[model samples]
Target: TLSLFYCMVGVVLVTGGSGLVGNGIREALGKHETGEEYDWVFLSSSDCDLRDKQAAVELFERMQPKFVIHCAASVGGLFKNMKNKLTMYQDNMDINRNVLAACHHMKVQKLVSVLTTCIFPDSIEYPFESSQLHDGAPHPSNEGYAYAKRMLEVESRLYREQFGHNFVCAVPSNIYGKYDNFHLEDGHVVPCLIYQAYLAKKSGQTLKVLGSGAPLRQFVYSIDVGLLLIWMLFNYNDEEPLILTSNEEISIGDLAQLIVNAWGGNIEIQTFILPTAFNLKYNAVRFQQS
Candidate 1:
């Protein structure tokens, strides 16, 4: 039996604390009213490599947190996901396993882990529900990462069923904000486009965007997701995972134009299989004139 004393006031540990979502949670908690109720320990990969079982156990023992918010995962953009599918799957699976196991062993009061909208099936109906997660296979482009995340949800439910643990999952759509990865080849759409557009302006070139600009996507700012997480921590206690999204869909072309407007530029759009290095000096001159 778990001791009542330890449960009364315990540390709150957030894994993957350096990334976008993790940083967002930290920012939100700093401004929250009840934030100071417990000691908050944010663990980045530098603090502890959670892929190792022993490291996870030792860190959990050292922190002795009664509550855990698991945000750690191997994440990447489209190119990286497609190129390194095996790495994505194995690394994330190990990390989720080690952390959730540690939390269970330590008898943590509650654990909130994050899931992404990409885990949904490729052929599912519109307006996604939690129940439709496993109805069909995910899109082929990122199936390895998607299936790995799906299993994490499965683990959460299994733990709840067998042990009656309060481990829960939070699913959010295409999160973007400050501290997001901005890699030219491996970053998400928003940051990648922003960085590319900046470069285009700087180098006197046209910004090269990949694929047809017709794909619709819904994006949630990391800070807003963070606030919702806080609310979930305090108010939500359930087996069903909560989907955190704004439900606003914008096409890639419109999104690109929005980015251009945000950056004070009007660039021409060209569709290509691979992003072409369009070194058009005229485009840069036009951008400058505008």
Candidate 2:
């Protein structure tokens, strides 16, 4: 009876439960159709500070979660990471390391870590096969963020290779949708443009986009990211990285227009900058959820 009790499926702990990815996954998992049983504690920013190792350990003990979806991150746009290099790198690294350590010791049924495609080098090889991860270097703007995430990839491999711990890793593409952050300084490209476009409409002015409009990017909706996270939890067991991209190629200029259109406006973009080699390698990930 005691052994069966330990094996019963129940609730799960989702760190960064407030983030776009975590929130999506929690909602999807929590909404399993009738008779499916699994409670979820959606921790807000107030529940605990994951940055503290003691707090992480304490949370793990209290929850005794069979599985942990570690989506908590000090993430942001390229500019923020580039500007606050030290803090960006150190904080993300520390939070991830502490959380994983706690998960390992607690014997979490499994752990799924989501990383960004930005972690790939500026000169990405076409098709962006999972193997190109360690090839060359990540874009400088995202280098710090990438470096911090690289640890999760490394640890997952080490844990599986040496200790046979269960873990899954994902490298998702540009994500955007409802509940996305729109903070002027820290938001990602889509949200930044969304906010900008809306504000420009209110102010009756054209929005200014930085860098060249030519660098291509892929945009995956929030729900898509959630589905992939859940899929990894159930279908994938390897430590190898998996990518999630819509592969809908669009220029920054076009993306800006889409945002403007999404905001119900036609705006002029008046900015000129040399096009850097930050090209996107079209990864085709479709939107999931029926």
User: Candidate 1 residues 6-118, lDDT tens each?
Assistant: 34557888999999999999998866765578877789999999999999999898788888889999998888888899999999999999999999999998999999777
lDDT (tens digit, per residue) of candidate 2 on 170-220: 888788877778998799888998888888888888798888787788777
Q: What lDDT would each prediction earn against the true structure?
A: 0.81, 0.76
For model 2, what is the C-alpha lDDT against the true structure?
0.76
| TM-score for each model | 0.90, 0.90
Give the clash count for model 2.
Answer: 2
Q: Model 1 — TM-score against the truth?
A: 0.90
Query: How badly does each model clash, as a count of residue pairs?
Result: 0, 2
> How far off is residue 227 in model 1, in Å?
0.7
